[model samples]
Target: MTTHYLTKLLRYRAWADQLTYGAVAALPEGAAEATRATIFGNMLGTLSHTYVVDDIFQAHLQGRSHGYTSRKMPEPLALNELWLRQQAMNDWYLAYAQALSPAQAAEEVSFQFIGGGDGRMSREEMILHVVNHATYHRGFVAEMFYQVPAKPPATDLPVFLRDVSQP
Candidate 1:
């Protein structure tokens, strides 16, 4: 994939994340923390899982240990705290993507999976995974929004492309 396309994807990811977090934060007290059928327990848990994965990938990109034994974070952060951390992570990704050269993006990185196994992917592939993974979990968060009888923000890539794309 071209760096231009990847950078746009990263920007779209950040935009979607902001909208998702905003919708969750606006929910009534206990709404975000409500028990759900999702694997991560609740909305916060689901989002936290995405954050942990992002952290893990960030370390992998840097060729260092991520210190995460599992994708699940034992203690989920409060909505505000999670948003803050996610924003920082999002910014890091944007900067990283912006700085990535064509060769760097194509270079394969090998790392140990948190679930125990060898894994490898190109740097661009890793970035794509991070963005795609978060998008997948945000669907879970959107599902939880209905439990609150609330409408989640439109976070589809098309929406981002149409409404937020920059020149």
Candidate 2:
């Protein structure tokens, strides 16, 4: 994939994440931390999982150990703290993508999965995975919003492209 496309994807990822976090934070007190029927436990839990996974892939792209044993964090971060960490990771991803040349984007990297297996992906593929993974979990967060009987932010890619990202 082209560096231009990679940069755009990361930008889209960051935009959607910001909107998701805002929606969660806007929920009534205790709503974000309330236990839910989902696997991650609650809204915060689901978002934290995405952050952890993003961190794991960040380490993979850097060719370093992520030092994470699982996709989920042991302790869920509060909404404010989680947003800070997520913002940093999102910034790192954007910088990394913006710096990639065509050759660098296509370069293959190998890493061990948190699930215990060898894994390999091109830099472009890994970036795609990170963006896609966050989008997938944001769906979970959006679902939890319904449990709150509240409206979630419109984080759809087309919305981002039309309203946020410029041509």
Candidate 3:
């Protein structure tokens, strides 16, 4: 896809990330970190994983090491801190996508995955993967909220598109 399209997708991803974080923020204090039976352990665990992966890909696209040895931080960040980090990372993705030339977007970035596998992706593909990967884990966080017996902010792509499409 074109860099222009990539920017739009990144913007959508940022919007959804904000919505998800907002929903988590509105939960009763401590609920985000409350232990649960999910792959990432809890809402905070899942959200931290998203941030970690986003940072990893951000470093990849920039041709730098993220300095992260695992898929998540050693200690999960506090929800507010994690939200702020996620915001900055999302902003980075938006700016990075906007700055790409079509050729640069297609440039192959080779890097080592966190799990010890070699990996390569075009800048565009990396952008798409980051967006898709975050969306996937946000689903896990939403499910964690249901265990809290609260509804989450709906973050479907169509919701983002329709919400922003209107005047």
Candidate 4:
């Protein structure tokens, strides 16, 4: 990946992560249970799905089988702990991505997906998928927050551009 593209993606990921973490922290203890029923089955579900998928891909990158049969949803009692775990994993991914060379990014990585034997993708493609996947789910979570009085944080690409364009 070009340095410019990587930088833009990194910034977008950071912003999206911040918004997701903020929304998760703002929920009341009981709200976690109501989350799924209200606003598209709860931000927690979306966040959990995001984390699980990322873990799957990360393990693939590291040449390990992703043992998960299904995406795990965060328990209401352990939502905070799950959020913190996801944050740490995301931080690790960002650091790994930033350190990758352009040549490394273009190189193909081989791995297996559930129900499949082997698969391959360029490192650049994997990084793009991770960012795109997170953005897609983050939008879902953001919509869940729409009915609440507090304005949802902007997760739009143009909004990200505007922030980056600022001096």
Compare the candidates by lDDT and give the number of the best one.
1
- Models 1 onward score TM values of 0.98, 0.97, 0.96, 0.81
Between candidates 2 and 3, the one scoring higher on TM-score is 2
What is the per-residue lDDT of model 3 for residues 65-154, given as tens digits with 9 covering 90 to 100? 789989978886788899899899999888988888889999998999888989989989999999999999989988888899899888
Clashing pairs in 1: none
Alpha carbon lDDT of residue 119, candidate 1? 98
Tell me which residue pairs clash in candidate 3. Answer: none
The predicted structure with the larger TM-score, 1 or 3, is 1
Off by over 4 Å in 2: none
Candidate 4 lDDT over 142-166, as tens digits, reads 6666645345677788887887533
**Candidate 2 C-alpha lDDT tens digits along 93-131:** 889898888899899999998888899999999999999
Candidate lDDT scores, in order, read: 0.92, 0.91, 0.88, 0.72
Q: Can you tell me which runs of candidate 1 are displaced by over 4 Å?
A: none
Q: 22 in model 2: Cα distance from truth in Å? A: 1.0
What's the lDDT for residue 52 in model 3? 87
Question: Which structure is stronger by lDDT: 3 or 4?
Answer: 3
What C-alpha lDDT does candidate 2 achieve relative to the native structure? 0.91
- TM value for model 4: 0.81
